[model samples]
Target: MTGANGVPEGFVPLPTSAFVEHLGGLYHAPEAPEHTFGMRVGPEHANVRGRAHGGFLATAVDVATSRGARAAMGDGSGVSTVTMTMDYLAPVDVGEWIQLVTTVDRVGGRTVFATCRVTAGDRLVARGSVVLARIRPRA
Candidate 1:
């Protein structure tokens, strides 16, 4: 079960609350704890032309940004996505596990900035930046 890096291969890397639970639709990072999101590529999320859908890429970025903010703020941080911009660099094939890395650039009293990248086997498939606003919990 060792992966290429010597880590256990095929082992679900993320927590149960992360992506696998959602059937590759969503995922979260435990180290960040501030964010939770998931990504999908390959055939399950491809377009009719057989390329990864642009909308899915954007959603992944947005989810990562929001989850990262949540991780930073902790439970009940009341963060919400305000804006997201994504750039599709290359086409991705089905069955390839797309890797997503999200980083929180800044966390202010009212806003958060995050960046994420989607890659397939060392090739960049998409990249994005997202802005989120922190709000008060609903009554």
Candidate 2:
């Protein structure tokens, strides 16, 4: 029951930028209560110690929280991270598949707050909180 490239059966490619594309592959499972984002760590994502870099884990959290904010705000409402705080709980090694479970904490008139738990396989690796400014187009 695996999808393309062996991602979980429910996950599909998420909307992303060139920078995210460079991170290997990103997937999303919208059917989850709090949408899940996933990626398999690659050699380039590792630090000199051969562990997944903090920057890479930060990016994963950022993307998950940002997307969670946008989903909470509904379609046509874009979001930009205003503040992000991350707690590194454990180290993840290269080649491990990591998944981020994002939950929207609140959605206000012009901002959204979200949090995420990052896991590699069954081990919790990180947790993050993000505040996103909602961007709406002017008429």
Per-model TM-score versus the true fold: 0.73, 0.92
Question: Cα lDDT of model 1 overall?
Answer: 0.67
Minimal lDDT window, size 10, model 1: 5-14
lDDT of 2 by residue, 62-90 (tens): 98888777776677789999999999999
lDDT for each residue of candidate 1 in 16-120, tens digit (9 for 90 to 100): 344534545454445533343434464666888997788767766766666666766674776778888888999887666566777789888888888888877
Worst 10 residues of 2 by lDDT: 1-10
Local distance difference test, each candidate = 0.67, 0.87
